[model samples]
Target: MKKKTFVLVVIALVSVGFSAMGQRVDRTNFKAGIHGGVPFGDISDHSNFELGLDVGYHIALSELIDTGLTTGFMNAFINNDSVDAGPVTVEGDFPNIQYVPVAAVFRLYPTYDFKLGADVGYAVGINDGNTGGGYLRPIIGVNVSGNTELNISYVKVSDDYDFSMAALGILFLF
Candidate 1:
């Protein structure tokens, strides 16, 4: 089922990754990105906005590909506070939903200015009642300047329920 699909995809990506190892290797670079998003799925009931910061170190696997490791913090701002318990009115408070993601990055360039990628890993929940989740983010990026890229992605974190978001981000590579 889902687990099998995940494993298959990972295997495919790794095979593709190894193919590029024989080509070229660029200097290791660091990247930082800022992202703003709209949360949906189960998280939408509690949060409306998501803000994230991503930092990574990467080296080109080939002229057309790059592989790296990325880690980031993402916070989903809580908007819901209280809920009704049948005839009783209940007032409660919960902290904002937050996750720290440690992931692997893979990017393929079709041209100098455009690329496609995905980050796959675990999102460790830092808020109450939440443990962690499997994380996946597929992205489309365009080079906006010398070392800057503008990207859009869909982020999904799956635990007991799915936490999904759509985000727009800007990345600076150095």
Candidate 2:
């Protein structure tokens, strides 16, 4: 019927409009960001906050999914080893811990404005007696603009201990 054809045409037009808007097309996109936060568990005893810069390249697999590779520099700032608790005092040395994470990222966009992803790979140790191990980060983000996003992630990396941190970051995509 003519009504059915008109409805189909309208639906097709709307789909095309969404594609033109910031929807993921089958292409590659790159992003860069800086993230910082506090370390937790065993690593917290030695470091305060960790700061990092990262870059990623993602290939859109569909309108709602992207897969990519990400790499970054993460540095955990060392804390003073002297512990002065009331009359008890102790002193030692704790150096900054540094790592480079190379990860594969898989992101799923639930809507145009929200996303969730996981990054998994190996972290290479750079300094401070850190012999690196696995790296895993799970993240959630909101797209605030056409080319910008805000995200939070829990990062876990292992060396002699689990060097884990929770981080917040803003990313610019291109």
Best by lDDT: 1
Q: Which pairs clash in the backbone of model 2? A: none
Q: Which ten residues in a row have the lowest lDDT in candidate 1?
A: 14-23
Which runs in model 1 stand beyond 4 Å of their true positions? 1-25, 83-90
Q: What TM-score goes with each of the models? A: 0.83, 0.78
lDDT tens per residue, model 2, 1-174: 643564465345334433543445557788999999899988787688899998987778787887767889999997877755459877877567889987777789999899999877778888866778777899999999999999999998855677899999999998
Encode model 1's per-residue lDDT on 74-154: one tens digit a residue. Answer: 999988677444697667897887899877789899998999999987788888988777789999999999899999999
lDDT of model 2 at residue 137? 91
Clashes of 2: 0
Question: What is the lDDT, from 0 to 100, of the residue 43 in candidate 2?
Answer: 76
Model 2, stretches more than 4 Å misplaced?
A: 1-25, 82-93
